[model samples]
Target: MTTARRGRPGYDLESLLQVAVKLFNERGYDGTSMEDLSRKLGITKSAIYHHVPSKEELLRLSVDRALDGLFEVAASTEQLDGRAIDRLEHLVRGSVLVLADRLPFVTLLLRVRGNTKVERSALARRREFDRLVTDLVKQAEAEGDVRPDIDPAVAARLLFGTVNSLIEWYRPRRGSSGAELADAVCKMAFDGLRA
Candidate 1:
């Protein structure tokens, strides 16, 4: 009998993604396989596949969830107006919170190796996100809201680099939810990093 055939109930889509993210980080995306995932979840491979078409689909969905919140913040009314500095602050704060809320998924998105077609697509979307933010940074510099010494492209990457790094050490505390962690991220990224 298959391992999953004898185990407890299989996890739902969200639960599966959470497990997959953890495994992707632990084993490296290239190292993990459907069998490994099924074994880990104690569910049949078919059961896993039923929830997600393929491992690539799981990766795509996970990355999209992380990116959606970010894109929303970029397009928000608060981001469209105000001093370039304020808009940049909103972007940074919103990004930090989104990253915190979706840390595992975002971390997985950042670690994509392009070993699969799905990863390459995710990489492309990530570049688009960077491009949008870079434009904002450039506008901020033009408005004297940010230090002009730094290149906007470089600044955008640096800001995201700092915020995304939260996944490396951040964990939800006993009383904190992912949203709370996101709030903390916003405070540190904008208020703390600004000149």
Candidate 2:
């Protein structure tokens, strides 16, 4: 067997996590093994262990990165300080940006089936984010910015469903940016929902 390269100065934890996340996205968290990761990184399994304790830890870290991006947007001053309708729009646009920027991590997050403890935790956090958006929808409805005819919970689900579906088919166009795509989502979502 060819011993993989060793002592590469650039193989830090962050870079290793990126490779691990990409592999997880491709092969799935449950299907991927440390051996597969080592082979893909061209490093020994020992080298990978030096960065993370185990594959589950890597999965936790990756999903956390995706979750953090979302929570940060929800907690941002812009998201908190606006009209309920505008704040909801900011959250939707921010989610699209996160999905575009961290496509692999977000994709893995969305596909997690709760088979592991890490995956279950990720799902719980996702539900919490959904609740926050639901609250925003309710506030918008109360403020008359959003139509009161639709249930807030259902509206939030549909709104996020549209945004989350980006993970399935979004690809980077040559000139279009995440912001541009987010603008389109906000326009399409709000134009119909706004009262």
Candidate 3:
């Protein structure tokens, strides 16, 4: 006969989500299974389900966490009230900080291939975020803070492409901080684009 099992102490939805996101990052979202999660967590599959109904729900939650951080930066007063170039710098800095702080989630967000409804939704939000940054680039160009030769959309794409690529290789070191990296990115990007 199977013994009655008690829930693990201190194990909650947030903790479960953390493990799920980490596993999803280490193993591709499509590659991980509930059994894998249960094995990693040392819990029964039913216990995993107690926190979230399905693996897809966990994916949605993980990508949403990354998207929420990006949206928060986009909605900040610094991003909205500053000169366009300053605002763009703030957005870039905020994005670097978010990626550093939430590397696993952001990495997963960047890797989503839109195979599922949640992935498609995440992709849509990413596109919307890109459009908002593109608008800032256009405004900066009009104000003569940024060079006019390149199209605003193209500039925005290149800027974000560089920033997003950080996840591939960035590992936090003892003295280095997100703000320092952000400063470097702004300096490099603006040095090239500033008029």
Candidate 4:
């Protein structure tokens, strides 16, 4: 049995987060003020404060949500134990699902420019995630699974540049399911890179 969370009648953390992400995506974080969130949410600033300590807290939560999802996929036992190429594929597929399921959070995350401490922290996490991908690419190349000519870092960026492009036009309830999209990405990305 679980007790219900107590909060103001209309707005909760989740809803606030949803609106905040939307506004952040639309107006840019620096451009979107607490006033904007309060107005768009049809609530007072103090009401928003009740849910989050500050606007930066909201930014931290949203970006962390996206980063945490990707890191979870990267750290999975399946991802850890596979051949490097296979593990890379698992990482890509799981990342696509993460982007699809948490589209808004991921969008806000990708748009971060390191303008503030929260953005800087998010960028650091992004770099760590990139390092994981680059290491895998190098391992795969060493194993003769990936092409030798390409730099591992370049290959890693290209692979994820493809995955990250999905955020540009992908919309839920469109024709492609996340699994189908992941399969397409894997086929397109791996076929060309595989040696």
Candidate 5:
């Protein structure tokens, strides 16, 4: 009398987040709707509600996935005993690995424009991460490893901007591994910024 559940399997929160991030990246978060997600998922909007109360909660989860990984790297890299410049390099490499591993989530995070409470919270976290990098850059400058001519905040932005730019063109399956690409980034960026 009973048949097996076949077709598309039930989506867990993780799987739902993955598809949501992909759609958010493709259509921009502001443009995407619960209806669109329900259509794509072959599930009703009420089914999605079973996982999360609202679309904004979904955005918060997706962006938090990215911010959590990034903060983990920043925290671990800070604890390493070495020159500030070396620690910064480690942070960059770890961040690239995060981007490659969670490309879709990071992509969605990068596109956030603070249009909602969730987006504003994400932006606040992003600014906190940027401050961490800026502090490290200032440490490197104080150690005489970084150039004194540039503002540490500017240097931090430029270095991380190069890393973040990967979202525009870098694919996980591209010719280089994340570590390889990170090496190239550090080599090019640090070479120019070093005193």
Candidate 6:
């Protein structure tokens, strides 16, 4: 059974999060005030407060949603049995899906500048995620699936850089799909970038 927020009467947490994420991306996190959020949602400021304690909580929730999707991919990859290269491909494709599904939130996450304590904390968590992926890249190199000449750190950065850049070019369309993009990414990354 699901329950709605007490006394809110209509808006639920998920809907509130969607509105909050869109506003956060459009206005920039620091630029957005709680009053601004309430105005955009066409609700009272206190109603907004009823769902989320503060603007910062909204930011934290949005980023956590994106991060949770990403870290789930990494954990699932670790569980699957295969060569490190195969697992790497799984990670890449899963990450693409995460970006596609949570595009707005992840976009906000990647653009964070560490200007506030919340942003700094998000940056630190993002770095930890990067480091975990870097280790996977290193494992792939040891298995001779990746080029030895290129630094694993550099390769990791480049791979994520390309994936992260998808938020810029990838507009969801009716014809082209995320799986198609993920397949292309895997092929391009492994066939072209591999040793």
Model 3: how far residue 179 lies from native, Å: 1.0
Compare candidates 2 and 4 on TM-score and give the better one.
Answer: 2
Judged by lDDT against the true structure, how good is candidate 5?
0.89
Model 3 alpha-carbon miss at residue 84, Å? 0.8
> Of the candidates numbered 5 and 6, which has the greater TM-score value?
5
Q: Which stretches of candidate 4 lie over 4 Å from their true place?
A: 1-9, 77-79, 193-195
Candidate 4 lDDT? 0.89
Instruction: Write candidate 3's Cα lDDT for 123-192 as tens digits.
Output: 9999999998999999899999999999999999999998999998998898999889888888888885
Which is the better candidate, 1 or 2, if ranked by TM-score?
Answer: 2
Q: lDDT of all the models against the reference?
A: 0.79, 0.89, 0.89, 0.89, 0.89, 0.87
Q: How does residue 81 of candidate 4 score in lDDT?
A: 72
Candidate 4: the clashing residue pairs are none
Candidate 2, residues 1-195: lDDT per residue as tens digits? 234574544489999999999899888888999999988888888878888999999999999999999999988824377688888988899999999999888999999999989999999999999999999899899999998888999999999999989988998888989999899889888895456
Which regions of candidate 2 are displaced past 4 Å?
6-10, 77-79, 193-195
Q: Write the per-residue lDDT of candidate 5 for residues 1-195, one digit (tens) a residue.
A: 012223668889889988999899999998999989988887778888989999999999999999999999998997899899999988988998899889889988888888899999999999999998998999999999998999999999998899899999988776779888777788888885456
| TM-scores of all predicted structures | 0.85, 0.92, 0.91, 0.91, 0.92, 0.91
lDDT of 6 by residue, 15-42 (tens): 9899889988888888888878767766
TM-score of 1: 0.85
Q: Which 10 residues in a row give candidate 6 its minimum summed lDDT?
A: 1-10
Cα lDDT of model 1 by residue, 9-61, tens digit: 65789999999988988898878999999888888889888898999888788
lDDT of 1 at 131: 82
Candidate 3 or 5, higher TM-score?
Answer: 5
